[model samples]
Target: MKHEFDSAFHPADIAFKTLKLAPHAWVPNNSRLPVLIYRRAVDPSTKDLGKTFEALLAGNEWLPQWRDSIFDYHHFHSTAHEALAVISGKAEVIVGGPGGEVVSVAAGDVVLLPAGTGHCLQSTEGRFQVVGAYPEGQQWDIRRDALLKEEIAAMEALPFPRSDPVAGRKGPLLQEWT
Candidate 1:
């Protein structure tokens, strides 16, 4: 799991914003960690955006999980944190929950969500898709409702990733997530 990233492709030019979402309705937002959004993190001109993200994320130890469109339903993962890197098109994403903040994301945008944070797709402009990853050794489970105490505990129990998925060691996540 100690693989180094091929420096041939880099996503070092990132403009990130941090937003802390409070526990809302059925969404048990992370109590201490703020979500990270990186605008234009990737190079839109890259021929294989998905492959580039996979290499970048995997190098940081947030192993790439899937390449697909976001589910258009409010849900959260209690087992692990998630990173979504938009590879194509644009979309309006609900970041926190039903009454949470909404953001417009396009190609090259990346959103990092803490465990227990709610998310779903609101709408898309074109052929929208993302390459997602999670912290090493962490698995994921989809929960439509965060109604159980065990779920909350599971989310709170997870630890922060050692490095930012996109930026690697000196990433903004280290500065902002804590």
Candidate 2:
């Protein structure tokens, strides 16, 4: 299928980081799945950054769920994993609950959070717009706290996506998740 930006032509050697977050306080961050972070996953200079990210993720079977700024409070999803692409400005985001990893993201960067992983916005520059997505069959739930058994079970039960939202079939999500 021809895409708007040819699937947002990204670099073959797109650099990424994977974090396996342990449970923090009441937040049951994923024990089995590490959050995936891709730096410069797409070209920031594109005329239409959000559209590029949407098409790329859609092609990979991840739905372009919403376009907004990250929530200012710490929270997480229990039912569905999430993919976020920065389309405007920059942000300092905290992932894996309070005192979790603090990441700085800018336009063109992408973050894939496993179910039950915590995330919140710390601060931003410019417009701070983000495009969020979810795997094809999974819908998201906001949870700041969860019963250990229930949250862990729900998170563990979720299936890993077939392809990486940014890296396509060869994206790190497949290898690391499985």
Q: What are the TM-scores, per candidate, against the unseen true structure?
A: 0.91, 0.93
10 residues in a row with least lDDT, candidate 1:
1-10
Q: What is the lDDT of candidate 2?
A: 0.87
Q: What overall lDDT, based on C-alpha atoms, would model 1 receive against the true structure?
A: 0.85
lDDT of 1 by residue, 1-178 (tens): 1112322345334577888899999998886998888877778778998887788899889998899999999999989999999999999999889978998999888899999889999999889999989999899889897558876776798988999887877777887776
Candidate 2 ranges with C-alpha deviation above 4 Å: 1-8
Query: Would you list the C-alpha lDDT of every candidate in the order shown?
Result: 0.85, 0.87
Clash number by candidate, in order: 0, 0
Model 2 lDDT tens row, 42-152: 889999999989999999999998999999999999889999999999999999899999999999999999888899999999999999999999998888776578667
